[model samples]
Target: MATIHKLIALALAFTALVVVVSPATYKEGDPIEHKSLTLGEVLDGDRMAHSLYDIKFRTDVPSKKVLCNVKYTEKMLDVLRSAIEDLYYFEFVLDDIPIRGFIGHLEEGGFLPHNHKIYLWAHLHFNIEYNKDHIIYANVTTKDQLPISLDGATTPMELVFTYSVKWMNTDLSYEDRGTRLRDNSFFPKNLEIHWLSIINSLVLVFLLIGFVVIIMTRVLKSDFARYNIEDEEEADDLDSDDNGWKIIRTDVFRFPPNKNLFCAILGVGSQFLALATGILLMAMAGMFNVHRHGAINAAAVVLYAFTSSKLG
Candidate 1:
């Protein structure tokens, strides 16, 4: 009986390894909290506004919830009005997923007047995706809202916010989940050929090269004929008629103004060129990460900082 049990355990381990099936017990975590939101005034992180979450725990989850009504004064309404005009988006952070919602969507992202009836997002549906027993992703979608007129309203208006939570089971790993989120990924997956974009790019390149080659060949052919002129008088005539790129020969060959600045620019360009080449070579050789952009950004930062003295 012990030998039979050993055989069963060995069979299970072999099957797991062959099928690459990942199985684990679910560990319940503390209640979800801290649903913060933020607005980025500038692209800079320091120039931003944050509304930290004031979390509350409840037992009767009751998928759909009516947290409370928020009373907004005219001043608050004006702030939101400006946000809508600027087409700002609200971003919230869940455990691992980053949720982004537009403050409000307008046709062609048009601005609305205060006198016009405006609608605010009142309900949100939170969809949580889990694999095996671990929460992997969370997403929110705006569902329903009623239009409220803010024209000539003296009383404080109530902005009711409600939310619902739902869980979904997935059979994907962490990496697969992330790639799936990037639905329109730029990279070629599984060595698949992107024939459409590739053909378009190739045709465009050939057209551009054809124009440049034809034009340059004609210009250089005339230049060559002038240079090889046997008659001195005719040669002077051809040189005098130098109108296109030939006219700038002396200027292009001469030293540029601001020698220091020119040298600095050249050095910086060369440094960056070298840096880019190195990065591409390393990336192709599997030095950096495959999908995570943070890795690329971190590599670029370190490389730029170290090579700044030489490049800049």
Candidate 2:
């Protein structure tokens, strides 16, 4: 009975610690206003000329009211009309932090032309951070979508915007902040990966290397064994005329015209190869700092310059 009471007390204490460490609390904001939606000026160019539908949706809830907007261009509209897929951009503000993201369909594949009026819904996702004193930092997350066309409709197309907010009890890191800002400004939703094509190329390369290695090994072994045979008959029959490589054996091992230059070039090439391999391995191991692209690029340039100094 004493042990059981102690176990119950321990469990309650652990639960209290967890609640104090990370508490989950959230407040849903009001629905975004429609009048905030505005249109930007349209420019004319071959493919560059375009106009955008600026969606300025605002929400008044939580501690303060925040506004988010996205731009949908004519090119995007045309793509939807042509049954092609695309993602549209939108920017919004939460706690004075500008979050940018895309507005896309939940389903995969391109949108088809519809004879009747269709309703396009906008889904919004907010990534929120919960810190001390119930402070919350929120931002939008977006995904890619295909272009949508609603032509030849009896009535105007209706765009209904829906939103969901997710919260976690953790302080935002520098990387998280940088990523949110960068993604809102210049990032797109879709990342194309051609893994199949890459795999096929790698397979071809390995096959070619294996073939060369096998052929070279067999030829070298045969030539050395034939030339160095203990049997006098076999050695005599394998003459210089029969083995053309044996005739130029001395030249093959001879030094190049500029020995110093050759050595310097070889050393430089070796250093570069080593550096490249080291960097690749480190990247694969996730050793580099994320969101420090400028630092990484500067370090690479300095290292390359230091290594190239060996050429002098």
Candidate 3:
């Protein structure tokens, strides 16, 4: 009985150690308290009117959406009515830190039509940095619209915002300074490909290559062996109306019409294949900056154009 009790204690200790070593999975914690957000006073700077778009946390009982509540002054409404461009600035407090952002025109168009509800979409960009289960800070800016009619009547408009958050572990033992978010950049700049994804892709490529190799080596070799044997055995029987691929041997080697066009197409295809392989190799080597999508696209276009000479 004493031995059994000792075994149970050891098992419990081992289980606890396993749990401690495992990575943690996070889910959205309780709707972050709305009381944590405080709206500041609105001010007009150089005829540019600014106001807070009070953010509210609605319970799941009704629906899951962040509601914005803002009061507009008559002068502000008048300015929005005639103004060609305007931006509303505001800030909110979170965890005793102030997060600043702005809302303004998202596009040249003043309104967006959706399901009979004329809406204006807002571009909400958050400048935030995160440390795993530790420190999270964010600043937000929006390109949202306030609907106003030519008649000067205030129209009810909905502000739609989309955002994403990236977290990092800042514990000194595992700190990655490159992954740290910058204040000037709204999006995380670190580009990392998970080892699992890379391994899966490599496995798929190897499987496909192996399949092709087997088909070419084993299957084709067997077919060629059988065909050659038939040719030898039926050398004299060939003219006796036996139909096989040997009958079209002459036609199989016949050149296609418009040989120049065909050769050009083959050359272009080979060039493209080489270009694709080089691009893939470069990507694997992390030679290109993945954070700058525009730069990558421009580089691809330039490379393709430069390699076009091989198409000849």
RMSD, model 3, all Cα superposed? 20.5
Question: What's the candidate order when arranged by decreasing lDDT?
Answer: 1, 2, 3
Q: Which candidate gets the maximum lDDT versus the true structure?
A: 1
Q: Tens-digit lDDT track for model 2 on 94-140? A: 33344444333324444575233322324445565645433234565
Give candidate 2 misplaced runs (Cα > 4 Å).
Answer: 1-185, 188-193, 236-244, 301-312
What lDDT score goes with residue 306 in model 3? 78
Worst 10 residues of 2 by lDDT: 1-10
TM-score of each: 0.54, 0.40, 0.37
Clashing pairs in 1: none
lDDT of 3: 0.39
Mind giving the per-residue lDDT tens digits that candidate 3 earns over 1-312? 011000000011122221211101101231211121111111111111111222222101122233233334455444433332333333333332344443223234334552222222233443334354323444554433343222433544322333322233334321332233233443355875699998999999999999999877875564455566656556554444445555678998999899889999998888788778777887777665422323444555656777887663
Model 1 TM-score on a 0 to 1 scale? 0.54
lDDT of 1 by residue, 51-113 (tens): 212222221233556544556666766755555555555544443344555555443343664
Give the clash total for candidate 3: 1
